[model samples]
Target: MQKGSFIGIDFGTTNTSVVRVFNDEHGYKTVNLGEGGDYPFSSIVAIPRQNGGSLKFGRDIKNHREELSSDYEIFTSMKSFLGTNKEFKVGDHRYSATEITTLFLKYIKDYISRTHPDVDLSKAGLSFPVDFSPEARRELRTAAENAGIKVNSFLSESTAAYFANRKAGQAFSKVMVLDWGGGTFDISILELKKNSITETAVFGERVGGDDIDFALAKRVHAEIIKKSEVYNPVAFEDMNLASKDYLISWCEKAKIEISNTEDDYESAIYNYGMYGTKSITVSVNLFNGVVEPIIKSRIRKAVDAALGRANLKPASIDAIVIVGGSSNLASYEEAITNIFKDSQVILPDKPQWSTAEGAALMQIIGGNFKLNNSLGLYLSDGSIFPILKEGEHGVGSVIETLSFSLTEDTQDAHFNFANEDGVMFERATIPTKGYLNEIIRLSARIDDDQIARIQLYNNSMGDLQHSKPTNVEVNKLTFYYDISGLK
Candidate 1:
């Protein structure tokens, strides 16, 4: 690595930011590169000419969203679509998912190289969702390599934010990092003492800023139908279809407006050439009333699941730090404030930048701040296992079928047969036997796009007052067989 400062690139769902750790005449500081010296929208490669010749990347892409859509190429929010089977098309040309991401990453690399010609591009740390599958991480690594940067490590988004917050001078023993980003929402409960971070538990849902946008867009459709004077449903549909770009753009703005306002709202609606449009103001109460419960349900469930996994009481949490674009919503902030009435909810400045900034902070802290001894598992015997016993170090055996959400279905997901907690099982190949009275921790690769979820001891604890239901989507499912006794 070069002696010069390194860069922290937070390639987010809605935006991307690049932060450099540099020392000037005054001292050390982290400077954000791009618009107004702050985070830049994570958009790149927009086609400008209706015929498609040159493409616009980054901030420039957003500036020319309209014209570029006509002739040039526009690839915005490509991050959220990663790992999906979707492809980007400009004119008649189609690109594979990873190729699209590469072009964007290359733009960032070129920007950095232009700004700091002498800095080393090798050994860069990339950030991914904590629950990202091994396959997804590999794709990201490949993307960075294609961008001409040698990736040294890939850390979870919340893990990066945890260290970033610590570097910014916040300290806690049991800190809950609630990172709601542009594309994903992850809540990580860390048993932090002094400067070290021990991840006690982690839970995440695919719901995020994109979901919020979708929700708001639905609301806008309803509002327009209710208020449009020329409201011919078929006509309106045709217009919107013809000018899909305009409706989407407007929906983006409406989402922002709802995020900023708390009262009934009104705005002149612009009509796309195909979608005949007019203006309408939505009652503040109407928008909030409809979306509030949905938002609360998701956030509460995710946060509670992580807390429940850690087996910690509400009072045990010392601080709750909300990170990500969705976390900035006043409704979310108010909800957290209401839950942890006594504990403060810390929201970082330029909230979206925290994860990438945190990743850089991890560079300074090294291996000490990570999850140690945390194991994932699957059952080998045709017996039910318990989740965890009261005060038990690990999940205890229960009498029910175990549900495992495997990400890639890889070898790392297997466990050596064990029935006891003290005996550490050695790594073995497939067709392994399960043991009785033995405890094993297993982690697996379930699929190409999703993270692996192993079924540990099942906990049939009765409903606790603070227990929140989590909504997770699993792409692959498997069962646990307790072959512990057989082995």
Candidate 2:
């Protein structure tokens, strides 16, 4: 482990992974850091319901599954809430998602400390979905720093996975990467150059493996309750959230088991809180019936959207690569195959490790930064001119030369930042300082902390509430952001 080199981290929704790259005169290689030499540790945290309970993670939390109904609180799917800036409350404590992420990262740091005593991880190459905004990135950086690791670079997960699969002398020119994880599904269209892979476009949605688990669990729970003569279906619906979570976890395990086998899979939950002795018989066809629609619809929209933005058709795609833990579903491959009949779809052997490895490979190859959203100024004619294009700038760099001048002498001149849909994220009034067509230089950037900071630069007026711009060097207003989130 080099002192200054970046430690690749896939801080995932369902599981987290860590890797350190060793690069020298020979070349670059990776050393995995996980229990049993595998690249995954459960990404969950458990807190006791009592006022003074210690935080526990990984297997320790799983050991307390039976106590979930009354004794503890479990936090999962926090990664899905990134950039939403929401908070969770228990007793008098309210923890923002960013703070929880920082704690989880700190736990990861401690694990690395214990498992590989010789290695010291400081700087990291953390992977985020392309949809995470500049604000989300900043929040992640803050969390990373709090966890004792400085985020040297933020690589989009799908793009990193693409690089992980790109081989020397490969014939493919264009590839689409699908990352269907527990809490989110991200898709990226990439252009493979003579020697490197470049991400052309990426799109994401909130649907993932967790949704399937919940849906299946609900069905299985209903079946269990129906077997109980005393508890009616309506009454069973009133079961506590903890019971729901427990059932969902059991269903998720069954889902994973079914993905590997070629036949029907059966799982049973014995002696639940209210329902005693209930079992589920899930065949590939049955499981597919529940999840296929979501997989098909989302994959279609994401793949089509990416391909459309990249100006390529289905036939033009050279390969479709699947990455992430939940991508092992047979339906995922089937749906993709149905879409691109002529193209080949690939599922890498170590899908879980691809993104983290790609982050390292991306760093070693000097990859560029890809902004997940578009920042632009809206024109008077309902049109927009873009600034800080995604995939164009280097990571953590600022866009300083994007200056705009007023074309009209109206009082409602607005500067906004948003996605391709033109919905405004945050807006500001251009303080002309009492001049017509004043040059207002706007330097907007996603700082190293992943916070989106837009500085309105002008020699004009200042910061007067109702008065013409007076004398403030910078305004104090910024949008709420940490990682990017999509509707």
Candidate 3:
């Protein structure tokens, strides 16, 4: 109920957290939102099988999981499937990822309203993974709006974590953020000046703690069958949904235990109908063997790629900030430390809540979003005609009537788009027939939604006499740029 308060929502894949921030005499203060001040609860939604039953979310689902039985259908990691054609069904009703997300967000809104009735939910910032497609980003915004929450801004997860951990008045020319969460791994290289933070490069993949949990569950299942006296025990893949879910939950707990303990950890599933009681001790070596491939192939590769794109060496990075639940793994920490031995590595006390807190902080201190890649046209002579240079402009800006001419008569004009490194990422073609020296006007803009739009017009003929250029084969291109910084 604080005046000028804004909320920051980190709607994560496995869990969700909300933080409320408002200015005070000192500066800004943040309050975590949840029942009993829990802040982050599970990002789970459950639908009851019985008719006319209410949908359950987060803590409600976790606390009553045992009673769910066959009467409820549970869904998690819905964030990963947003903007896709994937759907979840409850009885005869089918729900899209956006719909499920809306329901979950509405739950959070209602929960906060109970304690802070005067809090304005409209002014809020949301965090998302850097690798989320344009469609996914749009869908997330739609879901928030549908839930009656106005999204003031969208910040990438790694950037939010950086804002959360960064010290006031501290400056670092080059900092790397390694965010390994439940459903996504994101790496971002940022440049921090006095009051501005700019992202130089970012890389991400759809692999994280959830993946490790599933893999570990399978391994434990195999070990249990081998040690059991019953011949031809049920295969892990053939197990019932409830049994599988239970095993996965156990494995997730064991993964955390293994990370915190040096000794071999015992994982168990007890009194689960046909599964009975089974326990397996997992050695650190075994756990490492199972997760090393993911670490090397996805996590390590993403870090190297981000650094390469930013044209920075490990030693040049002043600090490395590690955040997210999966980052707690000892092996991941060790891998990061080894890779950047010269750089200072920092692990915040509450990595899980960092993104939400940082997002809230962003709402208090405004930031600007800039392009991390250059948008240009590839000329006929194999030369690049730059339209909008990287980091040259911030959002809500436009460039109109930038003049260009065809070098030769052609049926179509090809426009190639590349990142800052000159590696092509997209190509667009506009159909037109014009002689050499004919004028072509190009317009480019970055909207408030962080979408870059480019348009090409055929101004070859003397069409400037009219109110606008002559319309021939007009071509338009659009792409999302996921980078934000302080103003």
Candidate 4:
């Protein structure tokens, strides 16, 4: 935990996991925090500030809810909303998403400091969703830094999952990673030739286990209505209602337990409400029928979309790796087999812990390797405007933003993908032409490849660049900017 500690912090949508790398005489090894010793910390954050009490972290908030003040507040799914650059309200006061996120991360930092007092996490790789925009990427790093955690380069969650799978005797030159976690779902296509791994294409949705839990809760609520005549709908309708939401938390737990042993029919799932008078009972068959179809549909579409982007078919894929907590469902496993019949489907040793583990390993293995090419914008007059400059940047790199409008009727909008030395390799034609003054957005991305690919609909935008250990240059790098749509 000294020089190049190479730790990974997967600040996930629902749960946060950490992994520290170790090396000595026997080469390199990884220790996933949750699976190795103590349990992984939950991303669920609680504060009694709304109730005039002190802040609580991790197990204190989760296990001792009954002891909390009556007007206490807890927040989950912060990762999902962070991308929107919005603020969340707890009680009557509103706080920016970044502020609350920093608060949560500070707790994580304290946890690591207490547990591994000697370890320093200044070079840890931070994992974020593949579809995160440039602003979202910056936001995540800023929050982590504010929390007293030093973040070294970023890793796409799915790519990190790939490294974790490959380390465990997986022998696929080409693999697809199905990263379905608590609040996000990403399908990434990676091609590994020899030792180098590259993320060729990726697709993701802003939905995951948290969404599934809400879906199942809706189904359970309906069942409760049908069974008990004395049930009241008032509790479920209020957004300020914490007890009902707490009941939904119980439903989330039941979803996980049943997902692990889905074949069992002897046990029933139930979340009792208000002195155990009214409750909802769910069966395994119900679980599969209600939520499995949703998982199957989204996952199938994501996998197909990713493969299609890479210009490959299911047969071309050697193996499909499934990771994250939600992916452990027997139904999802069955769905993978049904869709990718030719490809070998691989499950992780600890499905939920792979991202953090692989990220830690990746920090040591592929330190500054670029995943994709840098993007440049070229005008019809043969002038090149480097949108995303082709070079690795500093830790506090400021990603530039450029916007262009279709001032006149134009036919050609060429995009050049190039390397660091003004060498262009690939060109893309954004053949968009219409009325004058039509503004096109350039929401820069450093994460997910596409939500809608090749439809003239850019879900997000990004570039890939490598870094070096030496700090010759600070965050004062300049870009060849042409913010206007003119030549």
Candidate 5:
């Protein structure tokens, strides 16, 4: 095992998957760790303290939620809160969300280290939401660094899925990635052109499986409230005795059963209660005439919103890749197919493994790079930076900025300009869908006046910028800042 064999970690909201490149008799294969597989790690985390000290981490934490007091910080859905500058309350000591996330990551790292005692983990690739900002990425990097892993770079979820598909022998020219994760949803259209992949536009919303689960829980509670008042005719307090976990677990199981059953099941047990020595089942129903529409509506709106953002009439996309655990539902996939008419939405083999596998491939390929063609500049070598002015929306006009870097003793670095097609976003007239129309076009000018500026800064003197390595590229050096919304 080399010191820096890039490991891909898809630390998701509902489930976490770790993938590493492994060499076997069948050649190199991406190994995905699941339960009971030599390396057993669950995303579930429990922070119960002994003698008032918080439990560091484990699957045991979520299992003991009802038994733990306020002192025990049993947390799930931490993935939803990433990039949000919020502090978590665990007993009297409060830690930022980023800090809590790092703790969980540390737990995973320790688990891996113990499993692979001989391997050195210097470089790791982390997966993030498509909508994450540069600041959010910096925070993620900081968290991973604190957890004792040196994060090499950040990979967008769709980007990771894209690579995963490629590794599985699926090829495409222009693709659309529809990812509905546990806590976040994102849709992106990418172009695979001229030996490079470019993400054209990305639309992300904080709505996914977790939101659906919450909706189900709320609906079940309401139904229980109504049923208890009419059927039991006792104090309302007595009817609330069932544990929340039992209800949610039953509901989850009921959901799975409904998705799998060929015959229409009429009723479902919402919760199971223990009475002295025996357990009793509290049932609910998906076939119930009243609540089915509520569940359907949520799923419908989310899907419509995702497709709308891609600005693609379903027929235009070459292929729509379904990702995230929620996409497994037969109903959801059917809905997507119905919406697209003739186009096909292919679910990659091992849908859950797609993102992590893709991320590992991204680690080998590096990121998408495009020349800043908007800036009409004729440059031989150096660094490029965009200057900006604050506008009404946020950052507006593009102003030229200065950048400096070090050149090697014998190598010459060539400065290149790369730009992506600009996106024009316009809100749709319809209220149900979040947003509408967007157009993508590559606009570059060869004129010397509009070219983006590139100037190299060197800490080590002697004016050696011209003599540096010519093999060096500006994917690392050029900085892109969108100034459209600003004044």
Candidate 6:
């Protein structure tokens, strides 16, 4: 651990990991914090029942699971609701998703500070999903800042994973990153060149490992009730909150066990309090059956959609890189291999930590910034005039000037900002009077900050080349960028 080095924080839905990358004589190196036992700890927080009791996080919540729904108010998957209006009510305090996330991150910062006293946690690169909205990115950044951490930049999880793999000597011309974590499934089609990596297409869904865990838990609960010897066994839905939460936890563990075991069947036994003890045999076939409708179908469609958006076919992909915790499942490998039979499928070492490691690597290598969505204008004929096409420019000023004549007398010139997909997300207006054939110059540029700045110059008022801008409007569209030089 060195001072002034940038750390990478993969603040995930179900788990969070942090890695510090710094340059030495040998080159870039990374050291995993929270080492020994809990390197990639659980993404969970629990509020104590008592007023003075300290809030619990990560392995603390796991070690005290039975007391969660009863003794403490538990919050998980806070990242999924980053930009939403979701709130958690605990006692007289209501916590927003951002607030809860801040608490969790502060805990992480403190934990690292205590473990590695000499390391600087001031600046770090954070990883987010490609499909995360601008609002979500803003909220995530705010949370980190609130937690005493300065965000250096944001990197997409898929891109981070690619960087990690590439550093490990896994190279490909065009690659698809299948990132199936605990809370989301993201597919990214990227074009890799010697100096840069371009994201061609990205698709994501909220469904993930948590969904599968719940589905499997319900299935197992049904089986348990059927074989119960009690006079009147309660259904899984009717069960108490603690019981249901405990069952879900058990099911998650069982799912992992089933995936890791080589035996034909793995037995999971649990006690449902008054409902008596029950045991169910789980096999690969049974696990697949429970998750087929939930996991397999969705990923296939998402992958296809990503490919279609990129205007690429299955054969066009040179390799498929699998990253994230849930990607370790055998079913995920089978499903991906089945679809991209001709493409090479690679599962990197320690797939769960790949994203965080990649984020750390990005801080070292530097990256280019690109627009995630197109910025353009709407024409009078219901068509779009692209001012700055998405993914065309990076990290500099791009100016586009177009001249248009007024068809008739108009007091105001309306500019509707649209994307290449024909969706108008914003509009701007310039107040100027002009008659027929009077030319107006519209100047548009995406600055280094990714803000679309548009200005209008009315030739009728003064010299067309020397006149000042009549009006300027800024459209806060979404833009994606990676970390720049850190040395």
Off by over 4 Å in 2: 1-5, 235-237, 366-393, 396-403, 416-437, 446-453, 457-463, 466-487
Candidate 5 lDDT over 253-299, as tens digits, reads: 55555555633434444232321122223233442322345335654
Please list the C-alpha lDDT of all candidates, in the order they appear.
0.57, 0.69, 0.75, 0.63, 0.52, 0.75
Scored by lDDT, model 3 comes in at 0.75
What is candidate 5's local distance difference test score? 0.52
How many residue pairs clash in each candidate at the backbone level? 65, 14, 0, 4, 35, 0
Please provide the root mean square deviation of candidate 2 (C-alpha atoms, Å). 5.9
What would you estimate as the lDDT of candidate 6?
A: 0.75
- The reply for model 6, stretches above 4 Å from the true place, is 1-4, 35-38, 167-171, 229-235, 262-274, 365-367, 371-374, 389-487
Name the candidate that leads on TM-score.
3
Taking all chains together, the TM-score of candidate 1 against the true structure is 0.73
lDDT of 1 by residue, 243-355 (tens): 55555556556666777765555676555453346676666566566557766888778777777767786678888888887776677787887877767567787777777
How far does residue 378 in candidate 2 sit from its true spot (Å)?
Answer: 5.8
User: Candidate 6 on 261-340: residue-level lDDT in tens?
Assistant: 74445455555766666667766777788877765568888888888878899999989999987888887788889888
- Tell me the tens digit of each residue's lDDT in model 2 across 313-397: 9998888888998888887877888888888788788788888876665456443334544555667777767766644543455
